[model samples]
Target: MSEERVGFFTDTSVCIGCKACEVACKEWNAIPEDGLSLTAMSYDNTQALGASTWRHVAFIEQPRPEGRTELPLAQGESTAQETPVGGDGELRWLMSSDVCKHCTHAACLDVCPTGSLFRTEFGTVVVQEDICNGCGYCVPACPYGVIEQRPHDGRAFKCTMCYDRLGAGREPACAKACPTESIQFGPLDELRERAALRVDQLHEAGVTDARLYGHDPDDGVGGDGAFFLLLDRPEVYGLPPDPVVTTRDLPAMWQHAGTAALSLLGGLAACFALTGRGRR
Candidate 1:
């Protein structure tokens, strides 16, 4: 019997800029503290995800649309806010938790010399640290730049989607600790349906910018195991506008190289035969 494919559906609209998911992820995974210094770029302390930081919460402060006095609250509710106006306009915060996509066509898996990165029974990707061998081939191969090597050891690390917890039939700590239920986890198919419905709800409530990312199976990386519902452009959240698997053309390149090698060998053989006949 096979396990059903499970993944995360992160709804960024409802995220309150809380770092509970980040804290829960670190505690559950026993990940080391990467840093404590503030980057001075908003309220974000851990600027981005890295080897030691498996989860990162991004805080983007942008100018709100003019005359938009009310903001849509979670679960399709709207509330008027007495927000302060910046020099440009009224500032609104966009918060999102960033993690590994666990791509269906994982480029890290394709480039890893060792069998360190693998797909789990639940259809998520995981890296076995003990087997990594510090090769670092997977670092640049990742399209999302999710995988990273520890500075001291060079072994690659990234989100495993809590493989151990999944085996124990529990949700990931990030999702469990999300107070707003922004990070929902369940069967991939179910999550997709739920996300679509959420998008429709937001749209009907006048949030026209609501959209889904990495949800389509026909996407360039064959979709992501973990997807997101965003209220703005993906780039605003520091996500790539278009992501393709880094190793998508490897098979074709190898086939062309083989053909060239065969052609060269045939030419060499013919020359040798002519030389032999001439000698005779």
Candidate 2:
């Protein structure tokens, strides 16, 4: 579609712990290796999205909770038991490759001093490496903590939504390389519709915790370009359950500051008038 723009709709329910997306992201972006040492945690060595690691696949291992299904439990065990089936229980690993949300009301864009970070016609935010100048203002400005400054160059980096590839009418390297189609890239509108349908499907399949994150336009960050269908609370994925853009209150804050200044000036003037009368 000529008018359609590209975006990501990550279905975390079916993500199978493959790190192919992470590999594709690093390879395509030419991002530096953050070391291959195994983490004490699960299979995830790369913890999260940073300057060196643009796409991080999170691995969470947990016993599948009961009570959501109608199946009968084994002898002497009730379905509501939080304990595992065996002595340890059946373990399942949830995997999701995380990236920059490309938020609609991006705080990074709001706080950038240089014109390096700009919004494209596709409605994605990207930083021009040459123009960044290592200000580091965009780091904390992001509510999601998705962007970061590279250790070597100090310039900030995150997912660009593959601007160059999108311009060439191709999918992002991560999406293309994904084996299970967990990371699906397409027009945002269509993806949202599809995500809703998939959520319904999951609900029918007894996965009632299935919910969409960052899909609504009225959300805190005005929605995200790269949203997800998470299987649990957002915190399970290390995301803020309710993330408002950091600068959403800028106008109101400035107004309050102005009022406080006026109040202080008025108090000082009154003091001066009383002092002058006493001196006279």
Which structure among the candidates has the greatest TM-score? 1
Task: Write candidate 1's Cα lDDT for 1-280 as tens digits.
Answer: 1899999999998898889999999999999988766888799999888898888899998887543445466564556354544456467888899899989899999988889988899999999999999988898898888889999888888999999999999999999999999899999999999999888877765667889999999998999999999979999998999999999999999999999999999999999999999999
User: What's the number of clashes in each of the models?
Assistant: 0, 0
Model 1 residue 232 CA deviation (Å) reads 1.5
- Candidate 1 Cα outliers beyond 4 Å, as residue runs: 67-87
Pairs in clash, predicted candidate 2:
none
Question: By summed lDDT, which 10 consecutive residues of candidate 1 come out lowest?
Answer: 80-89
TM-score of each: 0.93, 0.87
C-alpha RMSD by candidate, in order:
2.3, 5.8
Tell me the whole-model lDDT of each prediction, alpha carbons only: 0.88, 0.84
CA lDDT of 131 in candidate 1? 95
- Put down candidate 2 lDDT per residue, 22-62, tens digits, no spaces: 88888898888888666888788988888888888999887
